[model samples]
Target chain A: MNLWRLPRLRAGALAVWRRNILVWRKLFVPALLMNFGEPVLYLLGLGFGLGHFVGDMSGMPYLAFLASGIIASSAMTTASFEGMYSVFTRMVPQKTYEAILATPLEVDDILAGEMLWCATKSLFSGIAILAVATLLGVVAGWQALWVLPVVFLIGLCFAGPAMIMSSLASNYDFFNYYFVLVITPMFILCGVFYPISTLPAVAQGAVQLLPLTHAVMLTRSLVAGAELTQPVLHITVLAVYAAISYYIAVILVRRKLLV
Target chain B: MWFPPDWPGLSHSNFNRHAITFYNAGSMDTVENEVMAADAPTIRARGLCKQFADRKAVDGIDFDVYPGKCFGFVGPNGAGKTTTLRMAMGLTPLSGGTLTVFGQSIADHASAVRRRVGIVPQADNLDPDFSVEENLYIYASFFALPRAQVEARIDALLAFMSLGDRRRAKTTTLSGGMQRRLTIARALINAPELIVLDEPTTGLDPQARHVIWGRLNELKSRGKTLLLTTHYMEEAERLCDELIIMDHGRILAQGPPRELIERHVEPEVIEVRGEEGAALQELVASSGCRQERMDTSLYCYSRDAAPLIESLKGLHGLKFVHRPTGLEDVFLRLTGRELRDQ
Candidate 1:
């Protein structure tokens, strides 16, 4: 990339990151702690406590399996929170996007900056959760390092769709329908807590269509030191979905903000 | 022509020296004979129009905003003043005709045109997440100014707008007037050649409005051009070097304030307040002056008001007063008294 274009995108992204960090600093410390602490409590309370009952499933420790699933889930959750909730509020309620666009920054710069910011936040939260899981003896080997890139891919996939949903959503109430119908089903039925193969054949086929299921399977297999087979297929499917969702999001934001 | 002889007050040497000086001054004048031409106008609009569905928000309108002049657009609500101004800044697309800023078409070179113009929208659009200084610095960054230059400009603007004390305050914490001033300050971050204001003093108090007017005059002294849309007649009269009175998306009249009032209205106006009946109409018909009826008041326009007032003195239940006609009377006459569907 040309040096001039790089700074344009980098400056826009850094400005957004700095602004969000300032806001996060002003939020109550307890609120910030709770947001980071919830998943750790889940890891211990569910991964270890529940693993005691179902030990050594799928030839891997139950705690290890659950830890991988938590990392993928954390990536999606953090990206979704930033891409959907915060972006929507800034677009409609706060009118922050209007204020920014009034400057010389183009729509492409703003969208790219926002996506990068969401990815950064999700990556930070994912690594923190992964580090905590390692200390708890849940992650097994150096193979866990692969989870970082996988979590980043998951964040990108979720961010694209979340941005589109945010642009279409008219009010906070409209988000409830999306949360109940799309997000909740993906979390529960996509094998976050159990293997998809354990479910019926029909359920397994249905879970295969979801982005989260592919992410969870990839993260879990990588963390368990399992042999990699046809991994390119998983990566290809995610890349295609992310590309199409991003195209749609960019068009929608341009129509909504620029017009 | 023969030169006149020296007068008693001057000696012959003095006369000769004065003649030589005059001849040298005339020769230097020919050497520097090129006239200082006026700078080109900053904004030129011709037949600009905008339509929303079936309603024409801006009809065909033509005007020019010159450099270093405070140009005012005055009209009642829904007069297309803001629509026209937005089109000039390339914020809103024109339905028809051409608008050029700094000699470039708004359609073909919108970003380039926007680079030379600053806008203060009718409503405050400050970023809530950033502090006052951050808001200004971010705007400067949009123009791709260097970090050091942006910081210097931010400091200068903050002090100029009297906002140094509120540099760290969030936008939501500022008062209405403070926010308005901050918006103006943000517009100046880029140091644009032309600054467009859309009803900048709509809700400000008298004191705040005066402060803004004073700053605008200072900007004018520094050779900055201003295009403002306002409904306050007094504001138009006070600050505008030249003005356009618009109604129904068309220019009703345009000139200096005094010239516009002189052309469109009379030098003096006698206002009569009474119920309109046969007697009032008969009195007005026989008054022998240019007259217009608005609601319950009859405005008789003339260079002299005493004759009209003397004729109405004996009328019953009538209150009459004489005052100078102004831009408001011109606007009401051109746009009429009917409420517009804004």
Candidate 2:
């Protein structure tokens, strides 16, 4: 019930966090390229090739519209990759968590470190796309920088559920169901490619229930300098998703490893 | 050195873990030395038990590990040694009973207790992503050891494990012996007083096992407290100052290896085998020595080997060996020769 007390959040977790950064830095070029390159291709390829025919939607250029949407989705995708594959690999096959568990670190510290690392990776992705879009002139004034923090939130938000998947997974193949059933559907229906208002009324309401839609809405408004519609509602939804799933994720990891 | 440079699942939040308590003390090594001299147990378990969904993994076991000594648990594959060790580490929650380390119940103060302990798990869990030295540094960071001190300690540990030349080699690239040594070095990174090794040399060749045994002996000589589980009877006899032979989730016998040998087995053994062993069985029985029989061999035990050897002298086509009874005799006497897991 007390989610705040759930995470150990100790200096031990920082060691785990620092360890991840050290490894990431060692493989910086490939790690950065994988997270950054795909999104830019999505932004340029779909933004121009697809945007040319689509023209403007809701009085905005299609390329600009897609850029902000991609920012939020990038956070979701990158964090999901980390939370699912990396977390599972560390927890199971590599037995890295077992090694750390032998140290002063508790299970709470390991999972907290993992979620935070996932968030950090999410930021890396969102920021790269944000920078690219800013250079392309789609991004607005300094207000667009606010997406950095939101992207972080989205990263943490998405990482929680993705970690739950990782905890539940028995093998790497188990992640395919998550990507296919959960992530891909959200990517398509969450308005990254087009506005959700175009959907049928019943389908529009269904997409609103998904966390990615709220993420897309927040990033689009901030990056495109657009008017907000119930921004508090969007932020609240992301926060709730983050908090509940994070709590569940910690429990799941405990059951999977420590217990 | 608060933790001799050698050497659960309580909910983490209930007890505050003091990671840097020793560093605050000006003379940390002196305090550690004092603790080592004291008789207080670094690890104590009473009525400790663990029940899995389908099995009672550990059934009401009691044990103690003292500082500046090496202790051992020798058992078959399914004898619950690993489960008991895991419970001692607080990696698994106990089904019953109390376990205390550093005189504090692990159920309440695991982190505080764990800060002074190091472990080499049965499976190789080295982080393949990092090189040997980087892996050591990362493990050190978990204990929050000062970076400068850890840098110095890592060098010493690498040298101690004979890994000075391979500091930057990726862990995946290391041979099994080298990786096991690195795992041992990682365990010592925090300079823990209590080092728990689970099957430290299970898969190693004879040369590799000897290298490990030598390193373990050096750790013991350096006054680090060690608790380990091994299938190697010779390793147990050579290294363990005190040991427990366990089976079916219970300790069948516990004592110094030599004492266990003396208590349960004859001082001498004559192992006879060949096509002629059956013909020699009556001769062995006639000698009045206690004996056991396998498919084609007869193992005779006696307080003296004179009669057993005297009968075999001019015999042809009979292979025989005479040796002193060892821990293996006591172990097989108590636990039986049936395959535990199979």
- In candidate 1, which residue pairs clash? none
Poorly placed runs, candidate 1 (over 4 Å): A1-14, A28-31, B1-39, B273-282, B312-318
lDDT of candidates 1 onward, in order: 0.77, 0.85
lDDT score of residue B308 within candidate 2:
69
Highest DockQ model number:
2
Clashing pairs in 2: B3-B192, B3-B193, B7-B194, B7-B195, B8-B90
lDDT of 1 by residue, A58-138 (tens): 777887778788787778878887889988987778877666655555555666667766776677777887788778877
Q: Among these predicted structures, which one has the highest lDDT?
A: 2
Write candidate 2's Cα lDDT for B56-132 as tens digits. 87888888776777899998888899988888888877889999888887876778778899899998999999999
- Tell me how large the interface RMSD of candidate 1 is: 4.5
TM-score of chain B of each: 0.82, 0.87
| Stretches of candidate 2 exceeding 4 Å from the true structure | A1-5, B1-38, B276-278
What is the fnat of model 2 with respect to the true interface contacts?
0.85
